[model samples]
Target: MRKTVRVAAIQAEPKWLRLSEGVEQVVELIGAAAASGARLVAFPETFLPGYPWWRWVDSNQWNVEYSTRCRENSMTRDGLEMRRITGAARDHGVHVVLGFGERQDRRIYMAQAVIDENGEIVSVRRKAGLNPIERKVFASGTPNLPAVRHGVIGRVGALSGQENQRPLLTRALRADEEQIHIAAWPGNPEGEAAGPDSAATVSRMYALEANAYVVAPCAVVGAAAWDRRGPQTGRGSGQARIYAAGGAEVVTPLAAGAEGILYADLEIGSAASDRREVELAARPRMRRGQQQAARTATPRRLGADRWAVPLMLGSGPGGLAAC
Candidate 1:
């Protein structure tokens, strides 16, 4: 079916480690996207309470104080801040993909929450693995949490920061048939680089690989964030961008260090067209073992006992009875 959905990528800085203020800012952004007819809006990585850029800027011992503050300000799934975010989504009638520092027990994880238009929590996915500096403050996520969720805007999936560069992670999301994929990043002060490893390059490549709309919402490390952290550490320019199903650039890249919303009208019909050209999902070469296992597990015309015995004894012709 052909569907057109308006999506927004918010390229803005948080209120510099303040949870309540950050939530308020996000609420206003959500309202703005909704007002602009965006059915789905996505924010940058660890938008709530802000990304811990200080980890890279300050020394490990020096950043302890800042890290402590971040942990204190991190949000919980059912916390009041989350309720407010969901309330905003419900009130605006827009599905929201929000990235934040999620507090579970005593540990924090880089996570994103998918909120439905009805203001209900749909799925919360944690970053399957942490990047180098991130390991200092965040825990590794489970493999099962990387799948996409069905939303009003079709299958929505999200990955945080460096996870965008993980081919296997993107492949897993592709397997889930994501129609809209969110690549949430902490602004790359480095701006656009020549290599394929740059966030922008990887994001565009992911769009082409998945044949799905990729919405990259990046966070700007503005003066507020810098003021809290002391000084800028790396070259992180907030490069929020959107790409269509055919890997076509939809919205111009939001300027680095700028705070704004990048909007794109995604024509999902292009996905069908792109798939016809290269149907990665349907190609027989992909997931061969799993496919063979499924075919072998199919019930045969033989009596139930006969097939059951073969399957139980691991003596099937496919030699997958052990599976």
Candidate 2:
């Protein structure tokens, strides 16, 4: 039987620094997408309280007030905001992959939550690495979280912001049989002009590497958000896009500064046929004697702490605890 799924990439601005308002906006968007026949909807990175654009626009000390308010507005895994989002997903009968700032105690991480159609929280993944400016506000995450989960359409996974640029991490998700990958990115007014580090380039590369449908949900920084940052700051041009299993463009890139949902119907089962052409995971393995020899060799310390080892090793689905 042929399997097809309609997916949506949400490119909208959050109600800057207002958690309640942001959640309401997202809920309305989810309902709209569901009404339009979207089975899965992916939101932009840190759509809850919005991305830390101030971190880039000003110095750390200058952005302290914005940073503090952002943390105060950040949502916990099972917090009220999350409950509302999941509730919307359930009411609309649509799976949601939402990116938000996840707060634990006093620390916050760039995180994404995968919600099934029935309102169950299937998986929660944190960004394994943060960009330089992002490091000022978010903490690093471990690699042992369940990056992919079985959903109504197929296996879905997500990577936040710059994490889409991590080859090894994307490879691991591919090995876990991810059929659809969500590449959540913050707004970049430069768009494709931002060169190799641009979100557009990285997202397209991930689709080509994983041989899976890639849904790029990007945030838009509007005038209000710029006003909050400081005087005379500019807005971001949205760069939302969707790619098929064979790395073909499924939808034209959302225009810069546009705020709406981009939808596309994907052949979810076609990834199997694509994989057969170039199976990276099934190609070959090291000789048994060489593997044993390598195992016996002294392990090189990855970082100054024990947790760093696992972070560098990048474990598979079995290593993660049930969410």
Candidate 3:
């Protein structure tokens, strides 16, 4: 018998208040996905009670009380609201992987959890690393990727946001030989204006490289927070998408310009076939060898002025003079 599954991407914002409020939204999404005949539903990064944009670009005028309130409102494994989310999944007989503003020992981590069909929290993955700006606010996760094999299908893991840019982390996840890959993204109102689209593109590339199915659940900025910007000042909403092995589209884009759900059916085993046909390992072999060679290469001496000439001549956005 061929193995197949249906997945849904929840491309909407968190409730932006307390855990109960967020859970209500999550339940609604999960119910919708299940009603649509989806077995697995993926949500965007920090879709639980909203993302922590205040730390990075929310500006120097951030309301400390509000940030603290949001953090306090975050969910934990032992929290009641988490149980609600898990219970909802169980009741609906769906697997859910969702992003949450996770609080541990007073530190916030951009985190996600994988709940099984039985409504059990199977695995949790924290964002292993943060970008330069994100460092100001969120905590870095431990260096590990967790995947679980349930029945005939394989459940593997990864993260979203800036972590998508990290080759090392994704490469490690790929090394684990996951069949289904998840990449969470935040929606940009400007239509892929921010790097979310690029991140999704990168996830597809990773799926192609790793010979795994990629399910990207992107988040949309809420109507009230639509115009909000980080310190860098960018627009946002979230979106959800799924990519098959070899960068194939499993479903059409669900929520393109606004809040909605996107879903697709996945044919398993396809990734494995692609894996053998392309000899996926070979793609990384040359790069790994180059790194090994670089470590053994003799050093070359150059003056500080040598670097200056290239910058002076380089043609790019921030050119020599722009620098």
Candidate 4:
């Protein structure tokens, strides 16, 4: 049997201060994707209402309490609207991964909720860290976050905003054999100005290093979108791409920064085949052995011990320069 699944990435505008409107938009988008025969769909970061870039636009200029109220109003996890969205996913038999504002214990968080085909929430991840403007509105995630398997499809992990650029975090998560990696970009109105290259490269590198597939669904931002809307929103340019195993981009929906659904068919077996080939490679195994040998042969040194030799040797003409 062919191991295949159709996935979709949606890029669209979300109405601020109107979460009901946003959820309805998401349901509409998910319905469209299900009609296109997608089994899974993912949305951009903070898709509920909108991303909170306005927190940076001088909150002092506005009523401080009201700005806080606005953020608090947008944060939600379980409600009638959430149940409706999840029910739609269940009814359509489409697994949904969506970013939303999460309100928990008097704290607002940048969170993504993964709902399985049964309309059940499999995992909820709070953004591990906060960005510049985010610090004003949201809190941080705990340390236990990494890729977690939702159901039978694959292991899923989330990277919000610049967290995509953190190499160590990616490696740690990818090391565990994550099959589907989701990078949720906080969209701005400045087009690709907010590290679009880094966004693409992060997904590509994760796919290659993890020997798995990466689904990068970004927020759409553009000059006109910003000017017409307001400077409070940086941009709304969406770019959703899929990188196959071994760093090959299998399919990319052509419309960049536009509001639409980008679809791709994923083959999980391809990732396994790629990793088995690399694991069987002589160079890779030899590199591992070399690392082990170096670790064993190297002397155990503390701070002063490590510098002593270099410092003593540097004092002489033939000595090596201290690190």
What's the TM-score of each model vs. the native? 0.84, 0.85, 0.76, 0.78
Per-residue lDDT of candidate 2, residues 1-323 (tens digit):
45879999998878988999999999999999999999999999989889877776656566887889989999999988899999999999999999899999989988888899999998887776677888888887765434678766988888887778765567668768788999988786443465787887788888887888899999887667755445443444657989886677998877777788999999877665657666656654555554445455443444432121122112332232211
Candidate 4: stretches off by over 4 Å: 63-66, 194-197, 222-229, 232-236, 280-323
1-323 per-residue lDDT for model 1 (tens digits): 77889999998878877988989999999999999999999998889888876776757666887778888999999999999999999999999999999998878988889889999998888776676788887887765437788765788888887778766567677767788999988775445565777778888898888888899998877556666446644435658889987678997776677778999888765564566656655544425565556556754433211222123223334544421
lDDT at 300 for candidate 2? 41
How does candidate 4 score on lDDT?
0.68
> What does the lDDT come to for candidate 1?
0.79
Better of 1 and 3 by lDDT: 1
Q: Candidate 3, residues 1-323: lDDT per residue as tens digits?
A: 34778888777756664678788989989999999998888888888877654554445556465567767887787688888899999999988888887888887777889888899888787776676655555677765634444533555665677666565556556555677877887665344644444766777776777777888887665444423433322224434667777687777776454567887778776666566656655533334444445345543324321111121223333323211
Q: Candidate 1 versus the native: TM-score?
A: 0.84
> Which has the better TM-score: candidate 2, or candidate 4?
2
Q: Model 1: how far is 305 from its true place, Å?
A: 39
Candidate 3 local distance difference test against the native: 0.68
lDDT for every model? 0.79, 0.79, 0.68, 0.68
The alpha-carbon deviation from the true structure for residue 10 of candidate 3, after best TM-score superposition, in angstroms, is 1.0
> How far does residue 279 in candidate 3 sit from its true spot (Å)?
3.1
- RMSD (CA, Å), candidate 3 to true, equals 9.1
Worst 10 residues of 2 by lDDT: 305-314
Q: How much is 126 displaced in model 1, in angstroms?
A: 1.6
| Steric clashes per prediction | 7, 2, 13, 14
